[model samples]
Target: MSDVDAVRLDLNNPVFQRDLHGLQKVERHAALDTLAKLRQPNWQQVYRDKGLHWEKIVSIKPPPGIAALCSVRITQTRRAVAYRDGAFIRLLAIPSDHDATYGKK
Candidate 1:
């Protein structure tokens, strides 16, 4: 992601804060861990030539309206992508189910 393309999280946005806070909760720690793996060099490849790539979407569960597109951070940048109305909200940080699906069997 380019510096200009970098998401500027509105700290004042309640929905953004709420979702970010939810990600910090103890129950979601595993998700946070999965996000960490995504931040690696190999994982950061998707951001090179393409703005969005299929491999970056690690896993997904659906309500059809909401979705979690788990992707890695290339720099020290952190951001999230939530699906809404056929588009991404581009929130704070990507959610994950790492402990549940990344390596556990």
Candidate 2:
């Protein structure tokens, strides 16, 4: 697929950077591997990939300029909070707890 059609990974958010950098060595390695795989697919392919388990996060409010929050299984035991901005999948947070990813108590 062309660059326009391929899914882009955005890791510039401070929350994402801090959370990712705080991960254990193994989880960090897995997350990076998954992110690499994410860059290889088109948007449609990513949506259809059951392994990613892409879903909308309706339990919490999104930030300003963000339309909606979404989550993807970034590792075997971790999910990340993110949103789509054009062709970019801009990751916002990777909370330690699975439910926290949805911003739940």
Candidate 3:
């Protein structure tokens, strides 16, 4: 196992805070569980399973001056959007709906 401590979460983002606050109890728990897995060194393997449904978000361009973004399954109906900031996974949002999480199509 790699160093699990390397993963970092960005809790300061207001949008991420708002999205997390909006989740129901069960959804919040699920999201937390996903976050825990992401912190693990074997996250890549964990996300390979269909249940996680991890993938990069290409349709919706990231905000100006930002690099690429990605999304990972938080629950059946929710996703956690984030971007790679060096070794950290800076979670930006946790939209409950799929379309809203990805943006307008």
Candidate 4:
């Protein structure tokens, strides 16, 4: 697979672990499906209607110390947030509520 096909997690990040554990069955399935598509080389061409409204988190400022953050829709109510780490998308959180995904300063 090409570099664009990779998505990594900071398995060491407690927040990431916590958010993942908090997902409901359906939400978790959807998130995993999204991740699978993200692993494909042509993921950008994948349908957003199929559930990947990938977009940058622009409303709220990131918390202190974070440089930038972006998010992808996992389901209608859930979002998977991350930041670019070289060729991979390092997942940061999977917040169910839209507002929580943007985070606070």
Candidate 5:
């Protein structure tokens, strides 16, 4: 919605998608609310490195010729969202294990 290229979901990472999708059942407004707050002017600065884990939500893009991978960092509880870029994409959830070594809090 911020016009920053559509949010990419990596299907290869089923864990991440499953987690994010689960959130929808609990509170559809949760992630959307959090993301909306982060979309304000200078929002990046506010959420730059404010995620719960030892890691932060990284801003990424695919390099030339190479396909991108899904990567998500739960800004609230250190959850992960797995996804890739391109039409007819494969988006899925990535389990926390994949990110265990990255941002450990």
Candidate 6:
């Protein structure tokens, strides 16, 4: 639906919504703030943001229908897993720890 290449976030996934709500208020806010910042950049900028740490999940096989699974820092200490669907970053999870984000499942 987007003509521009700017990054867009898809937080509508049921698991994503659940995981986000599971965070403590402060952490949730931090994640939201990070999401806001993320939406401001194009994919190239996001890939270059050291703090975002955008990386492909090589440790786990991506589910069918997705090109690749990726993780990005959503808060100071939390990383969320997602896959790019067009211009949208479809966030799928906010793991409890860093390793869980891309660790073997």
- Number of clashes in every candidate structure? 2, 0, 0, 0, 21, 0
| TM-score of every candidate | 0.28, 0.93, 0.80, 0.69, 0.34, 0.91
Ten contiguous residues minimizing lDDT sum, candidate 4: 40-49
lDDT of 4 by residue, 34-68 (tens): 66767544445532435576677887676676666
TM-score-based ranking: 2, 6, 3, 4, 5, 1
TM accuracy, model 5: 0.34
- Model 5 off-target regions past 4 Å? 1-19, 47-75, 81-105
Question: Higher-TM-score candidate among 1 and 5?
Answer: 5
Q: What is the total number of backbone clashes in candidate 4?
A: 0
Judge candidate 5 at residue 35 and give its lDDT.
43
Ten residues in a row with the worst lDDT in model 1?
Answer: 82-91
Error of 6 at 104 (Å): 3.8
Top-TM-score structure, candidate number: 2
Give the runs in model 4 whose Cα sits over 4 Å from its true position.
1-12, 42-50, 62-67
The superposed Cα distance between candidate 6 and the true structure at residue 58, in angstroms, equals 0.1
Compared with the true structure, model 1 gives a TM-score of 0.28
Of 4 and 5, which scores higher on TM-score?
A: 4
**Model 6: how far is 78 from its true place, Å?**
0.8
Q: Give the least accurate 10-residue stretch of model 5, judged by summed lDDT.
A: 82-91
Tell me the tens digit of each residue's lDDT in model 1 across 1-105. 444433232234466456556664553564455344334344234345243332334454534544544443312223444332222233333434434322234
Give the higher-lDDT candidate: 1 or 3. 3
Task: Candidate 2: list runs displaced more than 4 Å.
Answer: none
lDDT of 2 at 93: 88
lDDT of 6 by residue, 1-105 (tens): 245777888899898899999999999999999889888557888889898889999988888999999998999889999999888899999999788897854
